[model samples]
Each structure stands twice: as structure tokens, then as C-alpha cells.
Target: MTILDKYILKRYLITFAVMIMLFVPIGIMANLAEQIGKMIDNEAPVNEILIYYGNFTIYIGSLLFPIFLFLSIIFFTSKLASNTEIVAILSSGVSFARFLRPYLIGASIIAVLMFLMAMFIVPKASAGFNEFKYKYLKRGREDRVTTNIFTQLNETDFIYVSSFNPARKSGNNFTFERFNKDNQLDFKISANMIRWIEKDSTYRLTSYQKRKLRGNREIMETKRRLDTVFNFKIDDLTPVSYVAETKDLFELNQFIEDQKKKGASNINAYKLVKYKRWALPVSAFILTIIAVAVSSIKRRGGMGVNLAFGIFVAFIFIFFDKVFGTLAEQAGFSPLLAVIIPNVFFGVLALYLLQNAKR
Candidate 1:
């Protein structure tokens, strides 16, 4: 609203925009250079390749937003301090806290953008990006789990498989069971192999056997083959590894609830995706404070010294995020803690640096 707020806010937004514009193409080029050979080998379509880069711009750019914002602030604010603009403003009776108002506004703007992108937009981009990566880029790797698969369709229904072939829509050592309301076994079915008959829309079970409980007696039946239908889909066995990242906010919440009901082993991985979206926006404020604090003081090494410090802090922030994220995904750590720790640590650091800057 004030002249000073407008002036600082304009520079804050412009520098961030410029930083993204400058670096995103560099990222695309670097990615293309690295993955071009793979594209050639796989005979990927031209249109899909173009689309992948577009998604790449959204996905990777959103991932690096905090760093870009941080570095941009340090870069521009360092220059302002170097030119004695900060000193002049302060000498004119502007409080340091008042000077920070515009920076907070800029951070607020970026945070909302990040929240929107992460919750809705980037998920679509992420789905497309990871789909392309797995389809053409990492063809040899299995996108879905293929062995020892288990899923609970409902409170009373459970299924298990020793091994599954997703392409064939078949599995070996298949077993299905259902229980009564009293938790008593109602019936159990086993098969040497089960395959989905696409033309008939039925599941064909080879070497089938079924056992039914009748009060205290067990009745057994066997058959060479049987065709039947079940409520659960084959894809429910093991979805793609990035399944969580592909869902919008509402869908993701519903998905996590479904997975929890089914006793999914990788629920932590899904939770990590949800928690990070919230954490990413909160980080915008923390990073902004730290960036301004570190870069607002004139130094002998000028902007170079401030830039170096910014980069160092940025690296550490990213390092902590990746480490905790990996732990949540692979090591079964708490997803909330993974998102909370890095932000809290950096938040405290920001407060310390802001006090020093004010002094």
C-alpha cells in the first residue's frame, strides 16, 4: 500500500519470476541432454516428449520453488544493502520490521501458488511425468508390485497371491477368504493359478478348492477349474509406486482412507505426499525470513558472500527434506515428523538470524 511496500514487493516478485524463467529451461535442457539417448532407444513419440517437458517444468519447478525464492531474495536484497538503499531507508525512520512487510506479502503470494499447484495442478503433471518415466524411460523396472501381494477388500473379505503377472492379469497360489459377522470363517477358496478372462469378464481358477464352515463341520469341494466373479479388481493388488503422488487433495484423502482400511503396507508413503504439500507452503514464509535476514546486511564480500550463505542454507534444507522423506517412504518413519522437523529447524534459524539482523 505504501510506496516502500510497493517498491520492495515489485522487486521481490520480479526477481523470483526471473529466477524461475532463467533456470527452468536450463533444467529442461539438462534433462533432455541426459535422457535423449533413452528416448531414441525407446522410439518415443515426439508429442509425448514435448508434453513430458511441460510436465517437467511444472513438477521440477514446483519442487525447487522455495530454493528459487530464497536465492532471489538474497540476490536482490544483497544488492540493495550493497548500494546503501537499506541504510537510507532505515535512516529515514523505517523500522526493520516495517521493511519486512512487503517480503512477507511476496512470500504469502508464493505460498498460495505452491499450495494450489501441489494440491491440484502438480499432481496431474506428476502423474503424466512419472507415467512417461516408467513407460519409456525405465522400461525394465516393474512399476507395480509383483510378488507376495495381499489386500483386504472389506472387513470380511481378504485375498493373497504368491506371485502376479500384471500383463497377463494372472496370479499363482491364489487364495480368497471371507468371514462372518461373528469373526467365524465362512468360506475359503484356493487355486493353483487365477487368471482374468477378459472376453468373458470372469476369473478362471485352475486346481480350485473351496472349504465352507457349517457350525462345527467343514465341507470341502474341489474342481479342476472354475470361473467366477469377485468384487475386487486385480489392480488393487499393487498399484503403481507413485500412485499417491498422482491424486488430487480430496482424492488423496479418500485414497489414504481406503488404503488404511485395506491395511496397506505403504500407507506411510501416501501420507508423506499429503504432508509435504502443506509443509512446502509453510516453508515459503520461513525461507523468506531467513533470506531477508541473511542478505540485508552489507558485507566486505558484497553480494557474493550473501549468495554463498544462501546456497549453503538451501542445500542443507533440501538435504534434510530428502533424508526425512526417504525415511518415511522406505523406513516406515512418521510422515508428520518428516515434514515438521526441517521446517521447525529452519524456522528457529530464521528467528535467530532475524534478531541478529535487527541488531
Candidate 2:
């Protein structure tokens, strides 16, 4: 549009880029330092290690995207304020709302990019990042799948296991049940041990017993070992940690729907991830407005004061987000509400600050 718009938008984008470049490497180095001992002890290969860090970079960058953008806005806007650039712009017949046009444009660009990354790119990177960590860094730790697993495979069928070993694709004390439309037990199967054969895609059941309930007559069958196909797969038996984080938006929505049908215990956690995919990008707009409003005024203590305030607000936003998210996951609070509440609260604050700054 105007020369003023170009000038401000360029500074905004440049500062945002610079902030990413600075924070991503620092995050990688700090994470590497913490995990280096584990890597060395595990004798991880060089290429794998490099790839892990590469994934880590994307993971951490997406995680901290809002904070970096917030700080970048504060830094440059504070500089513009201190150097009287904003004052000159305002005096030159540019209204405060008009002054914000370039910043909003810049924010829109970042928000769209962040949304794309969150919806598509970050999930793939998160999958690799977590896969490497669990495989190498967490070797010998407890299995990702918990013991005493129970799941409903579908409307009429269910399965249970006393304990499952994901590495071996086997379980002990397995039980499978099927029910009729009237919720009557149609058939029941029990096995002392069950193992999955990957090549054949069948289950090997040892010491298996089956009972058919046929109108007060029980038909019983027993076998020492039998191979049969079940409705469930290994993934149905053992869900990995971070499974929700690994899915893109479309896949995640389908996953939430599937989990809903199965009556999953951790559906709230999955819903939270889904809601946050949208919330994180929308927060970019709110944070940009707040940052410009807060730092556009020249302060007595210069950029340090504005920076401190910006960091404080950012931490508060993160704290509220985590607290509400945990409440939703554990305390049965609404996941959608948990994700939106923090944004609403801060968005109101942003509006308040913007109104005051405009005068």
C-alpha cells in the first residue's frame, strides 16, 4: 500500500524471522545438552542423531511460535516507539488504527503459516521426534502401553488383556466377547496367552476356550492353540503415547470420532490437541494486538520495561492454557472450553489495551 505500511511490515517480518532463528538453535542446543548422555549411552548413530535434532527443531519451533512472535513484536515496536518513529507516523495524519494495519497484515501472514505448520507439518515432525525419544532415549523404560488394557472394538465386540507387551506383540489373560442386539452375550472366548503374527495378520491363541450362548444351551469348545483373525489389530490393543500428536487435522478428527465410539478414557486429551490446532493460530492475532498496544508507547526504562511486561504476559497466557488443559483432561472440564477460555480472556485484555493506546 503506502511506504509506511511497507516499512512497518518489513520490520515486523524481519524481527519475527530473526527471533525464530535465534530461539530454535538455542532450544536445540539446550535439548541436546540434556539428552546427549542418553544418546551416547544408547550408541545412537550420527545420521539418526542429526535427524532427531532436525525434528526437535520443528517441534520446539511450533511449540514456542506464539511466544517468539510476541517477543519479536514487543522488541521492534518498542524500538519504533523509543526512536519516535511511531510518533512521527501518528503526527503525519495516520490514525492509530491505520498505524496497526501493517502489523495486522504481518500477523495474518504469520498466523496462516503457523496454522499450516500446526495442521500438517508439525504432526509429522512430532511423530518422528517422539518415536526417536521412546525408541532410543527411553529404552528399558516401562512400555508405552499400559497394563490391564480394555477396549471396545466395535458396537457388538469387546476385548480385554491383563498385560500387553508391545515389543513382542503379545498379551496374557486375553478375553474376547460378542453381544447381540439385545445386549445378550452371544459368544465368549478366553485365552491364557495371545500373540499377533504380523506376516499372517492373525492372532495365535494358546489354551483357548470358547462358549456359545444359544437360548439356555451352552456350546463349549476348547483348543490348546489356535490361529484366528480378530476384528482388532495391534494398534487397537496398544495405543502409543503421543499418538494424538502424530496425526494431522483430518486424521485427528477421525481419530476423535473413533475414540468417541469406543468410549475411550483419554478422549479429552485428544480433543484438546484438536482444539489447540485451531486455537494456536488464532492466538497470533490476539498476541500481536496486545504486543503493539503495550510496546507502542515510549517508556521511561526503554525497551527493557516493555520486554519484561511482554514476557510476563506471555507466561501468564501459557500458564492459564496448561492449567485449563489439565483440568479438562483430568477433571472432566470441557476440552473446547479449556482451549478457548485463555484466548478469550487475553483477547479481552488486548482490546482494552488497544482502546487505551488509541487515545
Candidate 3:
């Protein structure tokens, strides 16, 4: 690389490294404080807690790096302007856009790293983090837990559980109903309690009742014990207790597919999750541009003012992100649109600001 390239790169690297070191430990400490009590209450061992926090750090660091990189660029580039170094470069016949070459190069590197973290590393780590939380920190397990969870396994059937306990391998107050092509309930099954035998992969239900329709008549009968296994898999039970972020991308994708087949109504939630994983990394690029453009120009008010402005802009970005995401899910906008819409708008804003900065 040229001397100028090496010099600029060195400055950016120093600033980026400092911000990362500062942010990562704070992120770790904040997470540890929030989760440590839960782990202790759950009787988790120290080693397990350590491992959990280590995995959490990887996840947090991956997410925090892009914002830190953006802030670092702003900090150092603003310093260059305040000290008249940029003016010196301009007087030496270097174009402002040409001067941005090193910053863009650094941003490109960060973008690739962010993409890798979002697509591959973060998802895998999330699995471990979530497993630790569910197995150790959560209130109960999927099979031995008590929850009233619902999901559509297909379009025709809506499944419901009034209450289930993993320890008993059973559920109480359960109902599964199927509606006909005309949206009329053709069959319904209500059971007082349902139990599972892991060794045989079957459920032994108690106080079971079946209601059959005969073209305008209803037939209902009750039984004391019924031994049968439903079509649903044991793996399906996990999603009942976990949120979308707790599942990896592949898990989320499979969940949406399974739910769709079962006629699930909440596939949009999974779709939003899938879109968000990539959208978050792409947002780093736009935020980086905005940070660079905003701080590359010197002001009489100095670096502190610039830093405050950056913080405000960051908050605004996050606020809009959540707002638009809610609108996307509740208002029935496309999941892809919900995730990318803010980024698109902010990207244009960044571009306009950069153009004005160049002038």
C-alpha cells in the first residue's frame, strides 16, 4: 500500500481497536449483571455460567463491532478536520472524495465481517446461548414444562393446550379441532389430560372425548385412557417455548415451513426474523456512511458536539427500526419490506448528507 494509505489505515485501526475494547467489556458486564442472578437462582455451576457468558460475549461483540466502527470513524475523522489535517490535504490537491478512500476501505472490511457474523457465527452462538438459557435459566423444559402454547400445524387444524407439564409428561385441558372447507368445525377432540412415553414415542391420554359430525348431527363419546401418538414431532415442542431470536436462521426457516404445513398463522413472525438477520448487517453499512459524512466536516463546536449528534442519530435509527418493524408485522406489510424499509430510507438520507458534505 502507499504511504498515505498506510498512514490513514493506521489511524483508523487505532481508533477502531480502542472503541471495540471499550464497548465489548461494557457489553459483557451488562449481560453478566442481568443474567448472573438468574443462573445462580437456577443452581447453575460457575463453569457453565462462564461458558454461557463467553458465548454471549461472542454474540454481543459481533453485533457491537459495526456500530463501534462507525463511531470510531466519526471520532478520528472529525479529529482530522478539527486539527486542519484535512484542510492541509485539500490544499495539497487531494480531492475530498479521494481522501475518503481509506475510510471506505475500512468500512468495506467491516461490512464483510458483519455479514459473516450475522449469517454464520451469530446464529450458531445464538443456539448455544439459547440452549443454556432454556435448559438452565428458564422456568421449565419443553416436555416437563407447563405452558399454554398454540401453533398451526396446517391450514385445517388449530392446536391448543390449556396447560402442560413436562415433569408429568402430560397436558391438561387440551383441545384440537378441525374445520371443514366451509370454515365449519367438522370434528373436535377434547381431552382432560395427555401424557407422553419417551421410550415408545406415544402419548397416553386420559378423560379423552371425541365428537364426530354426521351431516347435521353430532356424536360425542368419552374414554378413560387412550394410547396414541399424534403426527407432530417432539422437535415441534421446542418452538413453543422459545422466541424467534433464540432459534438460529435454519431453525427459524424450518419452523416457518413446519408451521405453514400445519396451517400456522404466525409465519410472518419467522419471516421477519429471517429478514432481520441480514438487514442488521446491511444497516451497519448505511450507518457507517452517515457517521463518516456527519463527522468528516469540522465545526466550531468541536468533537463533543459531533459525538452527541452521532448518539442522537443512532437512537433515531434504532427507534425507526423498531417502529417500522412493528408496522411491518401488525399492518401486514411484507417482511422483507419491514426489515429493509428503514435501511433504504436512511441510506438515501446518508447519501444526501454525503453529497452536501462534498459540496
Candidate 4:
């Protein structure tokens, strides 16, 4: 790297580290406050609370890094501008675009890192953290579905699960029912014990009973020793929300496909979530460019004014993010548009400012 590149990189890295350091304490303090109630209510021990808050800060930090990145770029670049160091470099025949080479490289690395964390790392941590919260911090727990729960698979299907011991591969009192599209009773099948057959991805129901309903009278009933293959498994009935966010992207796609097959309604939220998973990572790059473009302009009001303006611009991005997300969920707007609108708008603004900066 050239000396100028190293110089710019040093400033950017220092700003990034400073921003993270400042936010880390704020996050820890906020986590401590949240856990205070949990510690009091559940009488959680110090070590357990410490672990929980530690994970909490990491999770929050992962989400907040993009915002911090935006702030850091503004902080350092504004300093450079106000000090006329950028002017000196321009006068030295260094093109503004050439100076941006290091910044763009740094931004790309951070963006890719953010994408990897959001896609893979955050999911695993979030799963463990959520599990801990459910076990220790939750109050008035709902009885999770287990053995002997009568659950509805869909609008036209009823399942009576007598016993489903998830740990053991055995379940008793299994009944599967399906109705016609017109809501007419089609057929009912009952079984003694159902075992999940993993190799073929099917269910094995042993010692079953079949009843064919015929116009509410004179239905054929038969009993038989049977090993049958069925598509739906015991795990199919798991509440979708119980799944972790990390798994949500893949699962939501599968779910939307399954729902389409089953003719279900209201998958907008899942659609939004899926788009958001990709959108958030790319946002780091766009927001960084926007931050630099906005703050690099020389102003009489100095760094404080530029900092305030940066905060305002960041809030605008965040506000639109929430607003578009809500609209996507409620009105079924194109998830791609909902997620990308802010980036597109900010990209245009960045280009406009950068052109003026070059002039």
C-alpha cells in the first residue's frame, strides 16, 4: 500500500475502533439493566447473568456495526476535510478518486464481513441466546407441543398425536385427517404408534385403522397391521416462530413454497424477513459511501455540524427502513423494493455529492 493509502486506512481503522469501544460500554450497561429484572425475578446467579449479557452485547454489536461504520466514516473524514488535509492532497495532484481507493477497499471488506456474520454467525449465536432466554428469562411459559397434543396441520387436516416423545423415536395415538377443497370430510386414518423414518423422509405408522366417510352414513372401516409412508412428519407441526432467525431465510423460502402448495394466506412477514437478510449486508457499503460523501464536504460550521448532519441522515435511513418493512409486511409490497429503496436513494445522493466534491 502507498503511504497515503496507509494514512487513510489508519484513520479509518482508528475511527472504527473508537466507535466500537464507545458503543460496547453502552451495550453492556443496557444489557445489565435488562438483566437486572431477570436476575431479580428468576434469582439468576451471577455467572449465568454474566454469560447472558455477554452474548447479548455480542448480538447487539453485530446488528449495530453498520450504523457504527457510518458514524466512523463521517467522524474521520469530516476531520480530514475541516483540517484542509484533503485540500493539500488535492493540490499535490492526487485525484480524489485515487484517494478513495483505500476507503472503498476497506468498506468492501467490512461489507463482506457483515454479510458473513448476518448470514451465518449471527444465526448460531441468536439461536443459543434465544434458547437461554426462553429457558431462564421467560415468564408464564406456554406448554410446548409434545405428546398427546391435538394439532391442526392446516385448514383441512387434523392430527391427534397421542404421544410424541421427540427424544425417543416413538409416538402413539396418531391420527391423520384430510378434507376436500370444498370442506367435505374426505378420509380419516388412525395409527397406534408412528415412527419417523429418516432414510426415506417419511413417517412409519404401525398397526393402523382406516375409515372412509361416505355421505355421513355407511362408511367403510378397516383394521390392519400396516407400515405406511406419509409425507408429513411430527416436526411439521412445530410453530414457525419458535425457529431461530438464522434458519429463517432458508426456512421461509421453503415455507412460502409449502404454503403456496397448501393455499395459505399471509406470508408477507416471512417474505420481508427473507429480503431483509440480504438487504442489510449490502446496506453497510451504501451507507458508508453516503456517510463519506455527506461528511467530506467542507463547511464553516465544522465537524460538529457534519456529525449532526450525519446523525440526521443515518436516522432517515433507519426510519425508512422500518417504514418500508412495515409496508412490505402489511401490504405485500415487493420485498425487494421495500428493502432496496433506501440504498438506491442514498446511492443517488452519494453520487451527486461525490460529483460535487470532485468539482
- Lowest lDDT sum, 10 consecutive residues, model 3, at 234-243
> Where in model 1 is the C-alpha error above 4 Å?
145-148, 162-172, 192-207, 223-228
Clashing pairs in 1: none
In the range 1-359, model 4's lDDT, one tens digit per residue, is 99999998888878887999898888788766776787678777678767666667667778788789889999999999998998898889998889788888788777787777766777676766676677667744422345455655677887767665654555788888889998877998888888776776667767777778777675656555566676566565433343436464566577667654443333466566667778776777677777777777789999999889888988898898889987876677887899888778888888887888778
lDDT of 1 by residue, 1-359 (tens): 99999999999999999999999999999999999999999999999999999999999999999999999999999999999999999999999999999999999999999999999999999999998998889976656778888888999999999998877889999999999999988999999999999899899999999999998999999999999999988788778778988999999999999989887777888899999998898999999999999999999999999999999999999899999999998898899999999999999999999999999
Give TM per candidate.
0.93, 0.91, 0.81, 0.74
Top TM-score model: 1
Better of 2 and 4 by TM-score: 2
Query: Model 2 clash pairs?
Result: none
Tens-digit lDDT track for model 3 on 284-306? 67877787789878898989888
Q: What is the lDDT of residue 67 in candidate 2?
A: 96
Candidate 4 lDDT (Cα, whole model)?
0.74
Indicate the TM-score of model 3.
Answer: 0.81
**What lDDT score goes with residue 34 in model 2?**
91
**Cα error, candidate 3, residue 194 (Å):** 3.5
- Best candidate according to lDDT: 1
TM-score of 1: 0.93
lDDT of candidate 2 over 57-99, digit per residue (tens):
9998999999999999999999999999999999989899999
Q: What's the residue-level lDDT of 315 in candidate 2?
A: 92
* lDDT-based ranking: 1, 2, 3, 4
